[model samples]
Target: MWRCPLGLLLLLSLAGHVALGAKQGRVRRELAPGLHLRGIRDAGGRYCQEQDLCCRGRADDCALPYLGAICYCDLFCNRTVSDCCPDFWDFCLGVPPPFPPIQGCMHGGRIYPVLGTYWDNCNRCWQAGNHSAFWGMTLDEGIRYRLGTIRPSSLVMNMHEIYTVLNPGEVLPTAFEASEKWPNLIHEPLDQGNCAGSWAFSTAAVASDRVSIHSLGHMTPVLSPQNLLSCDTHQQQGCRGGRLDGAWWFLRRRGVVSDHCYPFSGRERDEAGPAPPCMMHSRAMGRGKRQATARCPNSHVNNNDIYQVTPVYRLGSNDKEIMKELMENGPVQALMEVHEDFFLYKGGIYSHTPVSLGRPERYRRHGTHSVKITGWGEETLPDGRTLKYWTAANSWGPAWGERGHFRIVRGVNECDIESFVLGVWGRVGMEDMGYH
Candidate 1:
């Protein structure tokens, strides 16, 4: 073997250490020729693209300008998280220790500094004592998951006169709650878990309320959301998501049974469980077992219609029209838009107007959600500005904001809640109540 020079041996030894580090997945500058310690972000909120690794604290042109872009490194990134990569906490949660946690967000042209209205981090903007799942999604994603399209011929859409007549400055009642008026009929707020079953839950709850109201408390059965989650498939996708129109159409065409017969099991599995075989199928199987000679009906099992809603119609987008509809026809389902700031709401009248920086137009087209509009009232703010609000029963359980309820700005059709309000008449009969 040839003997190597001392200087060459030293170079080889250094190279070995670098190669070992590279194999261990650590960021090595010498081995990575094209790679350099480019400043993650320039003074402006953009990525740096200088050819030199150390530019003497000078920034280059920006390569990326998105809010949650990633910058790769190791120790430097961890030490200077805010300076190097503002969104590092979002993706690499354990990497950079949040010593001095980031304090605010610049959303939709508004600067919501931490400690003023809400807490801020890379993963979330506003922070409040609300449900965890509330912050898991953005407004756009939530809207896509919940709402179906609206039609011009819808009853709610047709009443442009009602909304036009109602003035925003008009004085209304100090407070109103549907639960207080009809404590026996109004159902408690339900928890839809992470599944997109708000369409089903709201539809079922509204139908149940309508049936109880029409029957004068004789039919107080908790109608099954599982029935809709499993059976109704026309323009609906079960837990993944479905349309309000499709849900109402299913209720009108194929009725549902009590929760005791088919319980809500959508949240039991990862995704909503597969559409189960209808209850009649199991009944037929049991009958066949008892009477060996009797042949089971060779029909599809989903036809066992126990309850139905007739002529599903939409309520007008006017605050008065919605209130009138609720008073006359129990609770109505309304489609509203959700936003990032809405998740942090604890109480008081929820108006999306930012006191500091953002514009209303920024969150105007965020996420869509459906809720049961139980009642409406007006609140006087500290500045003496009167805010009309609709009391809504949410599907996030009682532990959520305002005891499983929320108040949205009314009269102006805030969040489009008044845009696609749907109402229905549930069909009830003596035979339906165990008259068999």
Candidate 2:
């Protein structure tokens, strides 16, 4: 009995709307003469069924009842998501919710208003808080996951003795860069991706620079970190993480082929995932030299010749001494603590800020990582404040942080970057350079 009355009312309302539209020459605006209204973002469910509630045109009165609210399914809903359904993107558009959505993180029935910043490790989700397990949508998350560095200890710490002073009274420059002096001889930075193998990356990078600088540009090979990650198995856990001591040991003894030969394959989903098997091997050629026993793992690149390095030695934490060693030798490796805010670094003089100090202790995690210190500089702020910083090459690739480099506060052992600095020499001989 009641159905007839309700049906008649709906028909009359729709007819009046059409008659008005005919008089107005068309729907004056987007509000069609329908019997419904717009809605807000939907709850996580299947609400967008275009066949039923979908509007024939730009109808604001096209929506579905969902969880005590309306879920919009019309073209007008796309213009203003104040009335959009959560599942509209999935059910209607068949796509991930666009980043920086109408809201921030919606997680575990809670709305996080920070917008793509909260990285939930347990759920492996992100951005509007509905991301995939493998990727993130925030600038802080960047392109990939970062790895943990081995903690500092005697195993990875050392100092170089002054056998004889090169120049005791010479005044050092306020700034210096190895790349500026060496130019094309110094190779650019490389990417480590998600692997916890910075121990290998920094070690191999320092050795590559020293060898190239010492050889006077004759043997400028980008030595392979993949070589150490795969083959240096003495108390080292490959992608799981390792100490620089073990990496330097492998470079001095077993040696490694060029990056063009071995190539890195440690970007698996697991930060500590198993590294690929050693595809290339080397045999001692006597006189502290070696030769590759097989072709390069990357068959396309044929330069599989083995390269070795001399012993690794640590430098004094005194800024002057470290500077001299770097200018005379090449880029040196430094072990430092990486805090959560370190990942947010883009440019300018970087000192560990206290911004994250207020966060819960669990969220204030830090890790030890290694990098190549190629140079140093000082900056004067507008307020006449002077800042000193070390220029370093990060393994996160050229797209990040001053084209793959970062400047951290120097001299006072900020992040302990100066505490565990190291230097090494490449074992390049005249004959090894393919010349007489």
Candidate 3:
């Protein structure tokens, strides 16, 4: 009887030891290539206890916290962090590790750095830090610098007074409309906020617009700028103010789609479309679903070239004439000093000078200000400031008041204002001009 009991006790102890060994073995197995396990010891000096692994190099890069453990060894393990971190990893390797745990979110299978902005459902505006790289440049240089890689050739030729002539009733069948009559007329509205990929947004917008006009019809529906700005997984500069042309190349290679399809706010249940299962994060949704496969749209354009332009009118001494000529002829992108007064007038105002055009008093009284000039118009404000104004568009979106359109007071007889119009023009290759 004594021998039988002893044997039973021995068997129990052996089983317990095996169980402990199994647990330790599992942890050791997890510490594969590029990972070194560091075991902590107790006061007794014998391995007191918990075992942990310090990931090294490639494994460390793969073990980015934003993507979870799966991404560490799988998709990102072999690839350089530069390629994977652009749209995913929020934490910088060189920066000190954050004390309070940083939270991460996903959009379109890619992780985005969420620091300052509140994620809203309706108006998905992300508050991002200003990247100083984009400042200080002539409009031409800025566009060129931003579109460094994919240079386009076919330039959109604008005649002086095109904006004025295109307005309502001023000139029927304006150049834009006349171009529509031609065999190649491509025009499309680009959705601006979808992906925070402005480079793609602008590039695709310009390309598709030109292509529609030149190849298919007059203008195609506006391509969504939202997709370019928001959906790209390879770059993170969009919401922080990125270029437009670079986005086109990214989308061409990686492809993009609806934000609703990839919820970045931990609201996957609220996703509208079917989930893509083939992506790296698909397993998070659960098993049994087919893997999601990314599909590029057929409308993507691939040509990259440069174009040249001839001066329609040499700028003369008259600043007003120069401004008018630029407004009429080309889509001159410019950067101007913004003042509080410029934001005045909620909607309409009269100004002797363009500087005073958006005076706060006028904006408060009329509830509108014009930042962009399309053409000239005459309007009578409620404040009795009857002034001839130039039609302008605002970057403030449709909900901000004027449905994305506004007017600026270019000049009045009393105030001989000298408004600056920065002109940008270059020839792009005919093939570079994709569908509008």
Judged by whole-model lDDT over C-alpha atoms, candidate 3 comes out at 0.29
Runs of candidate 1 exceeding 4 Å displacement: 1-103, 106-127, 134-174, 268-305, 354-365, 430-436
Q: Ten residues in a row with the worst lDDT in model 3?
A: 1-10
Please give, for residues 1-436, the per-residue lDDT of candidate 2 as tens digits: 0001111011111111111112212233335432223212213345564334555445555665543444467666555444455556556667665432332223444332221233334221111111122133232222224544576565334334443244766988999999899998777988887676888998889999999999888888999999998899888877767888878888888899999899887575554445688788888877878889998889899888888888888777788888889988889998888764456455656666443354445445567889999999887755567778889998877766777788888889999998888888888887867778
- For candidate 1, write residues 1-436 as lDDT tens digits: 0011111011111111011111223244224421112211222111232211222221322122232333332234433433343333333343433433322334443322221333223221222343454443444444454332222335535543422234677644566676777888888877776567888888888998988887778787677777787778676777777777778877766666666556666453344346555442112222111111212122332323356678687556666767766876688888776654565555666766443233344433545567898898875655567767788888777877788888877888777777788778777666545565
* Best-matching candidate per lDDT: 2
- Give lDDT for model 1: 0.55
Every model: Cα RMSD to truth: 14.9, 13.9, 25.3
Full ranking by lDDT: 2, 1, 3
CA lDDT of every candidate: 0.55, 0.66, 0.29
TM-score of predicted structure 1: 0.61
- Superposed Cα deviation of residue 244, candidate 1 (Å): 1.7
